[model samples]
Target: MADDLSPEFCAVLRDAFERAGYDADGVLRLLGDSAHAALGRGEPEPARRAARDSGALGSLIRLFLLGDTLPEREVRAILPWPESVSTGVVRVDGDDVRAGLDVRPYGDDQGSWWVFADLDSDLLGGQVPADHVLGVGHASLSLARATIRRPVGSVLDLGTGCGVQALHASRHAQRITATDLSPRALSLARATFSINGLDVETRQGTWFEPMAGRRFDQVVCNPPFVVGPSRVDYTYRDSGLAGDDASALVVAALPEYLARGGVGQLLASWLHLPGRDWDERVTAWLPGGVDAWFVQRDVADPDLYVGTWLRDAGIDPRSPEGSARASAWLDWFAENKVAGVGFGFVTIRRTDSEPRIVCEDLRHAFDDPLGPEAAGWLDRIDWLRAHSSPDALLRAHLRVADSVVLEEVSASGDEGWEAVVRRLHRTDGPGWQHEIDELVRALLAGCSGALPLGDLLELLAAAHGVATDALVVAALPLVDELVRHGMLVPA
Candidate 1:
């Protein structure tokens, strides 16, 4: 494919996209009509990966690869992006309508992509790990940015697809080695490294194979977490396993590579056993000596779970083979004690003691504020575990490693407003709203940098006219926060 846009497609693509109700002008402005022109002709596969991860720009690139008459709707449909319009142009319905900004999207040889990390083109392709089944996307950046607070030394990205996560760590780690089982991916990763001039050690091997005797400071992976049948496809969603046990196997075998104080964070899915708690089932995956933060976001019951993955793999359940495959998935779950299936994020750290493993199922959307709050989450958990209740409080202003910005406003002169924040410990009750009980207590106890956490709780509870028992319960969670922020060091 030519690097320059040809005259033949430049005009036709613009006309067709405009007719299809896309913000043809604005889309072209960012990607450049020339870029669109190149896309209309479609670039070589080698260049497509970069395009796919470019977010909005990828959409325009998508329009080009799909053909001149391709509708803007179709391009967005592939990834289910949200409908958006700018430049006084009419908007058309796309698949999904997510919100954000400064999200530079570009179309390279790989696939549709959105840029979350400030990536240099030289660092792509060859820097990619052999384990990647798909090109890098925004998800890797989202995960990477969300983990700034966690300690990472030698990062081990299991199934390091396109080395997206590994590449992100180049700025954070002393060194990075991205591993993948696919040679093609490794080749591309090498090119990626050379292209971006970013240094990364790329290896060809599955999971921890290439890094046998070595360990990393940080490991970030977005493995094949989908629970699906063993399909021929092994790059993106499909894993080479009977069912989705590949994710479990990866999870079960990952702990050995973690070094002291190192952390491994991955996105995974697991079968939900009927007779067992999902937590217990996941607990089985832990190999001891690691602290884990496991959040199960959604649970798809038997039939639904099986069908979703089947459909996700582009298989139409209406077909006979597809129906049979769905049945097999159900059977697999039932026999394996799986009640359903779940999807979400998992973060683990190699601690000195028997790791404090935490499991939570939060069915919620992960958006902006989510990335910068890693520090708050790390602190929140610490605060919860150390004390029965917490008396410490945080100013709404947040700063997570350098990625978060907390804003606070007060009404005119003597008044102020703050965002009371908390990631629910268990959705036990009222975790989202500020539990002013401790806030009031802490205020009464006086946050003078000297009063013990306990004294604050006792004083505040007395003023709020609340029952002492109830006050005690609330204080415990807050105290846990204090220990987490290092506001109260461990005794």
Candidate 2:
């Protein structure tokens, strides 16, 4: 484990990093796109080759990122060697210096920062310890991108491994609290905060325990959501709870820690049972008085899921020990009758009115951050709720969202290039697509924000020789759905 450093030392360290240009852009520029991407994929030889002639930045990347040992004199030229050694940032063996922990540059649209975590198992040349503090990885980045980034009074980073989410939250949140089950994780989290000059309260406890009576305006979590047997192999990935219970517990307990109108976002995995609807299984986990959106980004069969996690733990599925572990894991899945594992994002907001819940599979690629879309979705829900009455909905004027594009598909048939399907596609955010019929297409075309929805519906009804009431009845629900997804916006 790494030792803590004083705030002054941390400030000095931050300055050294800044002066050496050891941040994301600096590293990327040093390594170039190909080598940097290769490093991101955990293949460091390309980065090593790229950094050979680079200066202090190269030494920093080699020592910290590639786990290379440098001459003490060389490392001393770049860092405050005495303080870095005393604080466990690096260790000295003879005349060589090596990083004691993993420190890497992480940034977003806001600013640059460094994350502290345990060294990779590959670098350690062994399995990670039980209390391993994970660095910024895919799931953590996904949650950070998906989080609604509006300014808030307070934010809680539950299961804050290495405080990555808290680091992002610090940009917008006035007060931030980060919690984890492992003391080592909390220690590294505190260091991460200190080194970044961020003021965050760090607590060591299980999910929601440290947050007993406190509530936050926003909570972001990337918990131990890997579904598996109730055995603890690693603290960062295993909750020691049977099958997705850890995820369930966190989701169920969120309402208590969330202030009224507060929002919570997390990356989670849920079981796909033989007969149960996957969406329904997740929907049942929602508590009352909260609006939730569950988007399943990927699904893996039992074997694939088990193999992925096993490899993540540094186990070869073909090895004897790995085979035995795989068999036991497979048996557990069979016993539970789990068909597949669904992994996705879950965003829930505490509400005072009738709760609106949406559960669906969104496996498409997105070009925009989900944070803005998430905030907009909640606001659209509120708009729909306020206009629940048919008359109220008809009175409002709406226009097609700027990001929406109408796509028409055609097939070569007997009639030659006949239109088969027409859909409304959102160009950004989640990239939601909705198929539409003639009536719906015409309604959207006429939605120029020049007239109330009711008047537009009546006009369409008159043009189509349909009853005005019937057209209004069919159009209201469709308009509501469109608005809920940001395909349409209030004029």
Candidate 3:
């Protein structure tokens, strides 16, 4: 077990960090534009140079972020050096000192919390160990952004490395369980939870084994979903499963662990086979009676995907070992008939007896804090699925989303200008956009809370010199699509 700092020491550390302004914004201000940008690209030299003349705040950054050695007296003035060393957080080397782990501030608009994990590539100046516990990485941030943050009774954070998700869940969930397969990860997570003054049931197990026969209101995971041919495991990256079975297994097992109306949000990667439909292949893994929304944010071909992950592993693709590994990955994909790999966010809810699936490819930038939008989208999906009949939809009142805007495109023809396309774009999740006809545009623009949708369609038909029934028939599907995708809302 990782040694826990006493409550008194935790308070002292928090006070010192707060006083030194050791936060995201604070670090950015210290490093300035060039160094901050360089640090973001996994190169710490620029930041190190910038921090050479820094004070207490710079000492903390150097020790944690860059793994630089500092004088004993300087370390003592900033923190409880004795306890930190006793706890295996740092080590003394001659007249200088270095941190054994990296702890940094992470948060959103609400507040901030510290996350502890292994030193990254920049600190080590080389490749990471296979079992290294990752800090708040891109996938971790993506999962945090994609989570639904409503009040809930219980939450499960599976594969909770360093307990970042569990810390986020603690904001709303009355009870939280964070499980991990590695004891080292769990130890760091425990210390992290303790330091944050948050209580979570930390269990050591893979996936759902520790939570057998238990159900939760919400479950979040950013699992080892990297598609690789590695027969062995990295614990954090490789699941030791062939292809994307790890992600598929997680999706297939959600129904049994999610309570009625409960949710499972995950960031995963799935293979796109050469001959099969990607949506169909993914949806087929969902258990019955669940409602799902899938947003495919990116797709990478074999060479690009392998190269990207190789770099993530800090392996040089031009090296002999890298060449062998890349060749093996490509060969594996070929044998499996994989065309490409798609990475995205998935939100699943146990809503009804019948399955409902909505899949879309949204490869665009999105708004930050996607949780609220994701929750609203799920509610809208339920509402739209319930009002499937034309008569049901006609009686409901609807309005365009507040964040939506209309865009028009035109082209010059031989003699005159011609309208190429008109689209409705929501300035939220994936910044979803949809094309619409003139009638649909007019109806959406004019909808008010008091008017029935049927009346609006009738008025639109009269204005456009079209039959009312025909207009409604042509527009209903489009309206449903808009509502389901969060472009329109129930007034």
Best-fitting candidate, scored by lDDT = 2
Error of 2 at 249 (Å): 0.8
Tens digits of lDDT, candidate 1, 1-491: 11111233323333443443334344555456556566445343433544455554455444333211235554444422232233101124454232211122333223222222211212221222222234434456556655553444455656665556655565557667777776655554544443344567777776677878776666777766666556544365566675557667767666667777666777777776556777887778887777777777677887887676555445678788788877877776677666667776777767675457767765765444333344455555544444322333322211122211223332444355434442212121212222333354335236454555455556676877777668767555554443343333332
Candidate lDDT values, in order: 0.51, 0.89, 0.85
Better of 1 and 2 by TM-score: 2
Q: What is the lDDT of candidate 3?
A: 0.85
Estimated TM-score for each candidate: 0.60, 0.96, 0.92
Identify the runs in model 3 with alpha carbons over 4 angstroms from their true place.
1-19, 32-38, 43-46, 412-416, 462-467
Model 3 lDDT per residue over 183-222, tens place: 8889888877876888889899878899999999999998
Where is model 2 more than 4 Å wrong at Cα? Answer: 412-416
The local lDDT score (0 to 100) that residue 249 gets in candidate 2 is: 89
Q: Residue 417 deviation, candidate 3, in Å? A: 3.7
* Per-candidate RMSD, Å: 13.0, 1.7, 2.4
The reply for model 1, stretches above 4 Å from the true place, is 1-132, 136-145, 149-153, 228-235, 242-244, 334-337, 369-371, 379-450, 460-474, 481-491
Q: lDDT value for candidate 2?
A: 0.89
**How are the candidates ranked when ordered by TM-score, highest leading?**
2, 3, 1
